[model samples]
Target: MKRFLWILFLGVTFSSTAQRMVLKKGRVLDSIPVAHNATDNFGLYLPKNYDASQKWPVVFVCDMKGDGLNVLENYKTSAEKQGYIFISINNLTDTLSISKNVLIANRIIVGASAIFSINPSRVYVAGFEEGARFASILPVFIGNVDGVISCGSDIGSIEILDAKNPFHYIGIVGKGDFNYTNMLQTENVLNKLKFPNQLLTFEGGHDWPPAKKLEEALEIFSLSSMVKGNNPKDKSFIEASYNASWERINSLIYSLKMLEAEDLITQTESVYPRLVGLDSLKEKLRQLKKNKIYKTQKRDENAAFNKESLTRVDYAYYLEEDVNTYNFKNLGWWSYQMDELKKHSASPNAIESQMGERLMGFLNALIQENIGTLKKEDPIDEEGLRFLWMLKTITAPKEYSNYLKVISSSAKNDDFGTALFYTEELLKKGYTNKSELYDLKDTALLRITPEFNELVAQYLKGARYELPIE
Candidate 1:
């Protein structure tokens, strides 16, 4: 691995004075301390065409790592294109109580509105992954929020969705993402409840969709406003939006993306009645619904779900037993199960492949929820943590922190060989934190050894520490 310099900047606090927020247009204000607390900082972005005299929609975003700037970057382009104010707190974590983060979000909302012309009727929340779940639940508690734009995840709790006060929901998920099924289920529930919603599917997994996808989500909100007469509906704007959506639906059908095509057709069917180009859209939708490919795909989807349920039940039982007994011997069994899932994901049968992706996603969610519960024990469950870290290493190899945890646990138990092995693995994953490599907890003995130093030198070239460098 090549040496990479990582710079971490501290959030700049703004005093709560009488002056309005002095902000530049079109650039992310990396951090703005909410309530003058460093830990309460949020990223803010204003459209280049922003006008203080006119009200604009404002979106509050969240990320699990409190990486406000990073999440905002994924959203700013779409926000700028749509002319919305955006803000996100960099202090939320899944381990923290949701109420605590809600308070942080509320503070930013109130603070931003005080200084900007944020339209209360258009207040929305958006987030990715765990943050997406957090955003989904906010409209229930925060009455000011009008809707939610959830990416890569679904609602934290469907119980919180109030039918009487239904808010708009725009779910953007990837077909290969673990939460794809969750989003699909959410769409049905939302539709059944008469909630205005749309589920947009792309082509990848467990990651943010492209900027254009984000723009489509914002467009949903914009279109909704026009329908409700909150914003004046210009005929041209409505036609352009309708034509754009029609083109996307047509493209999905032509590319054999039957599921995505069906979703878009359903969406436009429900929505086009109120917009321009309804006749043409209805004809296109009619043809799509009658297509042989569409019928076959829907049947296959149902079959896949039934098969996946059986497989999930079997795996769930063994995984629960393994966790209950701390069965290290079953680690190989778990590994095999994971491999099977990967294989199915690559299968030629499209339905089987989708089911595989959903199952993998389900497993990851199960382990994560278990880990969250286990961590809240009075005295932390080290053994449980170790088990989860090991599971995460296999299930989510891209997550380097779990590997670090395993290395730490091994070092604490004086398992130098295991610790060194993970260190090498972590470095192989392209981790560049040389400082933390030596400073890893309970690794004093292992960090000084030639084997560890040699491994470090292989990655971080000039590192030839005969003795502990520190």
Candidate 2:
């Protein structure tokens, strides 16, 4: 009876690790001076099927909300389903400090290796935002990540990565955000440095894992590890396989470069696809048979989804190929472009507090230049002035939507005269939104003409409904 009880307890304990995710149960090493107390800690996830005897590849994932362990859990299930070890850790430093990052990463890695049987040979790092930047540059500071996968943040370092130890990189970014520039630039530098890398861009704003990118990355992993099975292969067979793989890789590069060169086909004064003559590219690629293209090795659509780079109207023009007109152009991967943006990326002081300022600088000009003509003369100029003034009421970033509070209280009283001045300014500017006109409609109800209402309603839904004026 005693033996049976002990056996039951051991089985329960052993199988507890079989669940899809193992959470923040790993060892924590807090080397930071201030975090000396119990607060200095992190987490790791060992899958349910993880065995002490067999070694598995490692993938380090970092997230936003204080390590946000869920990302690890998600990646763990994904890795386990593919037979790999997943390491998730939290950064003690609130900001970007490389030395401390290395310490925390090494601690979890050492502990994971001892207990989880992690394969030291095949380690990968992945993260989002600050976490993404950390994982991307891990090879630079932390020493041993076979490859880096970045989801959302800027890598911040590509100049240091060259042919010597350039990491196999993969990035997924949103097309509508500033960081998409980073993804574009990383691809170029990786290609130039001869590092195997990919970037996928999606039509998103700010953040994404966006189903398609996961599929492509998984495909990259599988193709990258095709020869892992230890069958009865001898010296000659291994040599032949390696040679054949290089040939295939060379062919793919030749094709990818040719495709990238396609940008030369379309650079008009208008900077967009005219959707007409690109037949010249076929001849161009033929002439430069050295052109390289990516060839998908697997049939798995999930693994083939290349969302790291987006197909924007103005796809990047690699400068190495075009030396004359594009000297030191800020195009291509984020890491490379960030090198260009270093001065801009510097910590914001009052001088740089205006970085986020995208408001039209001409708003004040239009208000002051035409305020007289707005009230007494041309109806259109009067309309433009109203918009310019109302725009001034709003602050940078979070535009002032609460016009009720933004305008003077006195404006609410006398025929909303001040409000009328603001509304008319906007219309005269040649850009009309149904939303802004409708906002001032109740106060300046007399100015709400059908033409004005129609234009605003066309672009901004419920602009007319907000004030309920026809």
Candidate 3:
């Protein structure tokens, strides 16, 4: 049999069992059986479009019920464009999908680094409803995951998403989805827990991801990185901007974790903290108390929806209380959208880019403040600024030329240490720190451009230190 999942991606992506995305196909490992008389299909999914020239980041998806590959199948092209490798653990039962998917996500990550050119630091987990539950509590299983994304899942009632590691997270759901109430609480819990994540709500429920939501999901996925450095500016603005981005990113992550806990697991095992947050919120934010309830509902504002089939979601069953699945039909609140949520956000990549750009942007704003201060004028509020130089950093025409100028100028001034720092920044693909060494050999500086000379000089100067690249 071709299996139930292949049909889900029918006519969309090819199903060549021989092709791979990130994992070796037909490679068996420690067994994870499904049920009596049925052996579990434990393997990897290496997308057909994957390229091997450079190391790739990995995204591990749990809840592969034959359709485990469906997530990556249609989206491999998009993911590959970002240089990411997608891996899925299939043959998961709906009942045990979370647990099994977690185990596989962890196992492949450990092996991926050794077997492939996978960046150990850039690993991530993703899931849906039940699958999302597994993705939500990921910190409980692995010590390091770059990011997470979940939809319609049961995020257990716990503070499993550790705040220290700084993982990225995002949640997507229909306002009236069958599990909508749980999804809302999931966000509340995340806000309390302070995980770095984002939330995007649509107008439908308990169904496969609608096409419109996919763009937001991809935006979150792209934002889940840890590249560092910021534009040079007066110190205070740089510090404040980076700090705010950290705060916002961390809160969103906590939100996504909670979303997963609600949909993926069999129980609401760790929701007490969320209760505490709501209690605290009532006192701090008066408007939030007005509703005293943010459970998922049936009414929708989404233009692409079927209102006749939708139902209203009103119960907060997955709160600091009980857990129940409105499985028989469309759960009341988990079926539709809120027609009036047209808030202005940036472009698709803006949220993702903001994580880093804001830091630089903040730095630049701070520079502006400092410049004004030097001119004997008023300064800018720290919170009012949010910007980043990621695209500008890449597109600047004088990027390399300026690098040489800065390094050459620093070196001629005899600032060896500063020169070394700049060259290394380029080596690490980091921006900000200017280098001083632009031209140096054992006997004389090279005739190359200042930027190239700086790096070459540094390498030869400390030929013993042995920097990467020739």
Candidate 4:
């Protein structure tokens, strides 16, 4: 692996400065100032048993919004249990470019390396959502990022990956997450590049995996370290992780999640081969594959995946067309598509139901991306913005903010009809904050109008203006 020159530079310049600073163990230490740049800070978690005598593996946890303490707290349990030093960047911002964020992350890493006894060969980065994407990109630029724990996201940029400099890529995502398919696809790409990678899926949606799942990820890192001779073999830890894998596999099988169970079994087989015997695991996998129920479940899952792929293509094409042309008429079509997704969610077949939930998540995510792009336009595409806000009202009715945006924008354009129509729609969806309605931006005329007040009164029963005996 190429050397991290940045670390060498910081080690020379900041080591003396860092020697004077004391950090608390067994608790999160927030706002530890970077030695070179005191204004920039990071959160750190030293294991309770941490000692300067031995180097420890470190995981740099990224948070785009820089809620360092919260992100550190979330991973502290596993880090503590696994004896890994955890650090969170406290100044990362999504508003900045990726390059800028990478610079910020580099500074944090430099600071941490200067202050802590971190094993350079076992350094890892981790995060969820956008932060996870950022973490995955770090190994491409910064040398010696041993692995990445990407939660609910895929690689930030696959084109930039160097095949010769592959790192262990461990992705944890939920079955119902929109990024689930993306992570699986990324795994295929990593395999083509011969990158060491694994994808761990759970039974939930687009959120951080539970602590147990994170512990499993850390365990994999530990096992990988032993395999590469970076860390001494710990017999007790290996046996415990092996036993946990079997218990999880059994639970998954008992729950009839055949595919998930099979995936876990495959992962266990790969991780434990060097440390323990795998004959039992291999035979178990062989028998599970031959089981009629497992075969049927696998077939149904593949069919659902095929169906979801086609549906996703349709959604992407139509959403692009709808957004580009400001196709207000197609709003009904989008509504109908959402209804179809709801029907799929209500299906008796578990795989089909999961496909429905995933599709809905994908559509919402796609729409959000379009919305973000339109928001960044120089002139602020009002027509496109209005169309998306209108669509949001249909797809996510409970999101009252989009309804207000639609009403405010329509009124700004002097389209009182559109404004009043959404006013009633918003009220019909249980919006009762009359003060917010009256105070909405660019809706002064619309809010006081008889039609708006009448609709508000009809739904919420306390409009500012009376309907005059109608």
Candidate 5:
């Protein structure tokens, strides 16, 4: 079966000579046509030193929005530094089913291999956010995916993981990201399944880790390749990486990030066991574990994690109840919850603050998922949808679209009172596009209402319609 899949992936052919003629090294080339599919294309980046004489490791990047060139640019520097060929699929999107996207990814992979001298043993995949979630699952459908560098996300589904077909999984996430807790939990599961995995965290939110962090991931991949005998070992490279790991460990300790320091120590021990001794790392970890500050920080973090877990359950339960019941009356209660989250965010305890932020992000994502699913229902539950959209205005105040949806949907139902309320609320949140307000969908009559115009005049100081003084 694997052989057949391999044949299927490699069957598509491109004129290698012609591709090589136009392709430039050390630059991101956009819109390279897929061999079998004319509509599908991908972005590519070859290291400056790339040559067909030797097989090079490749990282297939998945961008959920299909903006391949832009996503490729984000990873180009790390790929260039690590001598890995980087390619991004231009047609993969979250809107498409996972099966369809995986197929699209397979075609791009086939085209890339046909055009470049790719190292089959060292082939990997990477992505950020939704893209990361997609990349995490690709190895299941595709053959020979050696590793996955998932940024800001965890595995697509733990149930799909197989112990026999293990792939090196490297997750890079921010401490404040909603997925941070999920990644940590996933690491525990991966460890039990005996999958070679590492979770790297930074002090930030749910976005791409810095370029240096990506370089570190590539370095880990390189070190793993050496350990597996897939690449020739370089003593200098191993020592340099070892020294850098120690430096990072110490720096993390100095910054009072005992958790990160411990994680790095564990990762260093795992990657360097073959090339280096374990005595120093073991002793350092023992000492760090005994430190009073480390103990306190670990305790606090555990407490916060427990609290966050319970909070997540409450949020999930309540959100489902509210959505199904069209509990518009509970909107005020949701507003109170948001205020409490704000208070937690401002707490002096860093862990608590981060937990608050994660909770906020989690609730927003939950609401968004509910809204998306609700929109796809056969007989669209307009009331339920409106309630979720109204709730979204509370959960994600800066997201103006939800407010607009509330206005449009409410107006469609002839509830101008709700429409006028959201209009003023949207304006209060700094929405200044008068034209968009006037042109809102299903608000043809509502937009011209005296109430809507008065609210708009009050907030924006200008209304399209001038009301007569009665």
Candidate 6:
């Protein structure tokens, strides 16, 4: 008689006690159980060229909501481009304690290694926002992770950074992301620590980088591996990457992104010396800086950044006071401030435009922090939540969900005027979910009111429950 063991891979389960489970390559497996007895599932992807015979780099991704499949999808193309495996944990929700979430990520790491051909020298972690913060901290707790691709957030705790075992850190952030300044600051800190790191910026706000940028970040990982002798250096790849970097800098110079381009060249200067024939790159960089236009641009950018910083400080101070004192009367003043930021964002001056967006982005992060604190109150601070939510609707006006939150919170307080105002605001933002409006908790009486129904009918064409106006 022979002993038997079960192994599942890609919708197929095999019975073999002698061998570990082997997953199919090339496509995403939406839910692969950690083990038959385990409660959590993980999303996984293997390159089409993957073979059990060859060890491959693996990246573990985390989504705050535990949506492993969706998060894994973002890395699919990048994995294929870089010859890596991608896996995402499905049980690491924000509601869980940080310790628990870290443990969950570690379990997935161990479980995936057991089932796949993972390279011990090249394991990485990546995630967005809360997930990104979790990824940034994991290497501190788990020794196996060699690098992190943190998107839209910085490391949650600076105390955990181990100087002796610094990992390769790639931070991807949007120009308009709330985490933009933090990511830049993190990059500077990593530079001083002599840690291998790169900060990639895109053109949006507080979201995952596009697939192309993810691939670029992964390429940086591959290049770092080659530079460190973890992987054999290919002359063709080295030359292509170096040339691409030069081309980007040149493009930036042509487009009046002198400061950004100078920063990029400076950031990569240490790494490029490893590639042959790139010694002249530094000279080219010096020449770029000496250009009269570059000097002028740098001066203008400094002025804008400094002015924006002072304005942001003022906004932060008053917003906190307003939220704490429930100064609803100051709401009009906040509205005017948002409008001014928007106007600057649309200004013809590049520095002013960028500073404006950054100011707005910073405000979003500040308000969100206040909101998180209010929600964590033992008895629940409804007034604080309402104030922050109202501010959020003005600052992040495009976010329809904030408008919805305001409506629900206002209705709970029986502030029908506030509720009705936000109901119209939500609709104006193109929120057409009639059922969602009807289903909102604590909104029963408010939704049935003639004012609420009339607004709903005006925007969405009809309301589930309407009251006739006299």
Pairwise TM-score winner, candidates 3 and 5: 5
The alpha-carbon deviation from the true structure for residue 267 of candidate 4, after best TM-score superposition, in angstroms, is 0.9
lDDT of each: 0.81, 0.47, 0.44, 0.87, 0.88, 0.82
Task: Provide the TM-score for each candidate, comma-separated.
Answer: 0.83, 0.45, 0.41, 0.91, 0.93, 0.89
Q: Which parts of model 4 have CA positions greater than 4 angstroms off? A: 1-22, 455-470
- Compared with the true structure, model 2 gives a TM-score of 0.45
Best by lDDT: 5
lDDT of 5 by residue, 1-470 (tens): 11111112211345332333356678898877765564678888888888787999999999887676877788788888888999988888888999999988998888788878888889999999889999998998898899999999999989998999999999999888999999999999999999999888887888889888888999999999999999999999999999989999999899998988898999898778789898989999999999999999899999999999999999999989988888999999999999999999889888889988899989998988888898899999899889998999998999999999999999898998889889988999999999999999999999777888888888889899997689
lDDT of 5 at 227: 92
Model 2, span 148-237: residue lDDT tens: 778865665776675887666778776444465556677777777887766755545456576545544644544454433312224463
Q: Least accurate stretch of 10 residues (summed lDDT) in model 4?
A: 1-10
- Model 6 TM-score, 2 decimals: 0.89
List the candidates ranked by lDDT, beginning with the highest.
5, 4, 6, 1, 2, 3
Give per-model CA RMSD. 6.6, 16.7, 24.9, 4.9, 4.9, 4.2
Residues 332-359, candidate 3, lDDT per residue (tens digit)?
2221111111111132322222222222
Q: Candidate 6, which segments miss by more than 4 Å at Cα?
A: 1-22, 443-449, 462-470
- Candidate 5's C-alpha runs over 4 A off are 1-21
Consecutive 10-residue window with the lowest summed lDDT within model 2: 1-10
What is residue 421's positional error in candidate 5, in angstroms?
Answer: 1.3
Clashes of 6: 0
Model 6, span 308-403: residue lDDT tens: 778878988998889879998898998999999999889888777777888888888889888888878899888878888888888888888888
What TM-score does structure 1 among the candidates reach? 0.83
Best-fitting candidate, measured by TM-score?
A: 5
